[model samples]
Target: MTVEIRVSRSPGERRVALLRDGVLAGYRVERPARPDGVGDTLRGRVVSRLPALAGGFVALPGGESGFLPESECEGRRLPPEGTILTLRVTRAAQSGKGLRISARVKQRPSGPLALLERGPDQALRWAAAHPAAPLVVDDPAELARLRAALGPRATGGAAFDDALESEADSLALPETPLPGGGRLIISPLPALTAVDVDSGGADPREANRQALPELTRQIVLRDLAGPILLDLAGLSLKARGALEPAIRSALVGDGLVQALGFGPLGLFEMKRARIHPPLHEVLADRPLARGLALLRLAAREAAAAPHRVLALSAPAPVLDAIRALPGALEEFAARAGRPLVLRDASLEEVSDA
Candidate 1:
């Protein structure tokens, strides 16, 4: 029942992984973007309205567009295309998805709109809100940031080492080992995620009984949302009937809000509202986002690097993202009191920085 939060510097972003009893149950990648738009009020122009979708797209001042549901605009007049109005971001931008925006009315809002934190900050907030757990980070600077985010309750140090890094790498794999030699395979598609549970020849009921709690843990850990279909390996009608109650109890026990039931074809169906993008999506689809993340990591490493110059090697896309944020990158270098050398990809094989 022990929970551990490991914060590490990953290419172009800060990666936070949650381990329950040493098993990677959940993870998040935090990267800065053009104001993730969540919980922030901004002026935007109506780009287009889609009656079929029950919403329209609004182009924010920052040039990115978000979706405005008709429900949110019920009391307000529907502004025409190019009409400017202030709105708040209900959901952040993600892969092939725009922000979920809601209408706002503040005739001369006093100050800048506040933004909701995501990734590392969100993870810290979650850790602080939950049962006390050891928070581990690889960098002293990051540790300080965690302290600032969590206040006095935060207590941890630079505990991430080579061995833990390897453990993290293994834990990140799609296929994860379950207790009792069973395995869980998670496959994500563009529309939804599918989790296949293999009981490994054990009693289907018993194995599933043991696996449901861990499954819920994974769901929370991965920040998985929307539709999820769990394909448990074996189950008879009676077993399924028994499994349903167990699954419900597990989800409730974990304090997770997911509608659970069996589907038409005997597959276990689950649906949870999307609050944030999963770890893979943030790291894979958002290159520029990751680039900003890398810059942030560089700023942190700059302080500890033995030399004044910090060497960084990452994919071309990530480097491009860094270049896109020249001002931020320069500021990061200034704060670290070091110059950064972006390693050429040809000279060194590259992955995420």
Candidate 2:
């Protein structure tokens, strides 16, 4: 088996893609300045309690808050508002939702909040552990960091350009086309992610059989978590029986596979360990994409007025992201042979950018 790693460096974010036999197997985005606090432990105070939902809110030291389920209370009395407690993040915040925390702290944490290594680095170590699989990074600096982090297994000089950027974009697509004229529609609900399997005029069993491997790869690649409902088209008892084994075979060696069974109404139910939000929500939760869009616009506008001071305006979040990247704006301005000015404005001015 051949494994290839592609690392793409952009301002404020670094994206990693893993390929197995030329197929996209894994994808991750890391924003060093702003990390997803998946494994972080925070000292928090109970801010709200809801007995009906069996969950409540905990406010951390930095004014950030997370949802605390009753199960995370560990049989202790439900703390009233303003009660102090320690919590570990179960799932990072995403799509405007707060972090998911629990009372169970696996290790002693440091600071008011403690962070663990990002997912890409964790997966890089996993790849490096296999001696034969070569690791590649596009940036020399990134390659050096990985080598230091994972010994000599890391290597440099992989090609990454707009085509690879497009390939990375495809990983987060909602509708995934399958071989043999089938498709999988992945929908992220408030509770869990739902994947609808469509045979697309092909036999349901055959399509499902073909889709499982790719679907399994996507599950790991996208880092989708929590309960997953696979709605197989025209599922029968016999076909369902066949699929259980097939699904098991597909998921073999993939990390953190959980309960697998058919739920009410024959929906194939499965779960994956969720440490962080999936790629879609990760990108959505940050202003990196918006900052990139604004840079693209700056590129275009710079060409039109090479010597003029180009003014770029965006919301506070986007502006913060743009400025977070060292030398990015200055480099662009230098290339344009002009000065660039940044402004804070509503997204209306920056949406198309």
Whole-model lDDT per candidate: 0.67, 0.73
The candidate scoring highest on lDDT is 2
Question: Candidate 1 — which residues are off by over 4 angstroms?
Answer: 1-12, 16-26, 33-35, 74-83, 104-156, 159-171, 253-256, 285-305, 308-337, 345-353
Error of model 1, residue 153, in angstroms: 4.5
Give the winner by TM-score: 1
Runs in model 2 deviating more than 4 A are 41-59, 66-90, 95-97, 100-134, 159-164, 235-238, 285-290, 293-353
Estimate, for each residue in 75-183, the C-alpha lDDT of model 2 and write its tens digit.
7456788777767777788645778888865434334442333334444644765556667775565677887767766677644556666767777688888998999
Check candidate 1 and list the clashing pairs.
Answer: 11-353, 12-293, 12-294, 26-221
User: 127-235, model 1: which lDDT tens digit per residue?
Assistant: 9656587677665556687777776544556545666556555444688778888888888777888988888887766777778877887777666777888887788
How close to the true structure is residue 232 of candidate 2, measured as C-alpha lDDT? 83
The Cα RMSD in angstroms, rounded to one decimal, for candidate 2 relative to the true structure is 5.9
Q: Each model's TM-score?
A: 0.74, 0.70
Q: Quote the lDDT for 128 in model 2.
A: 60
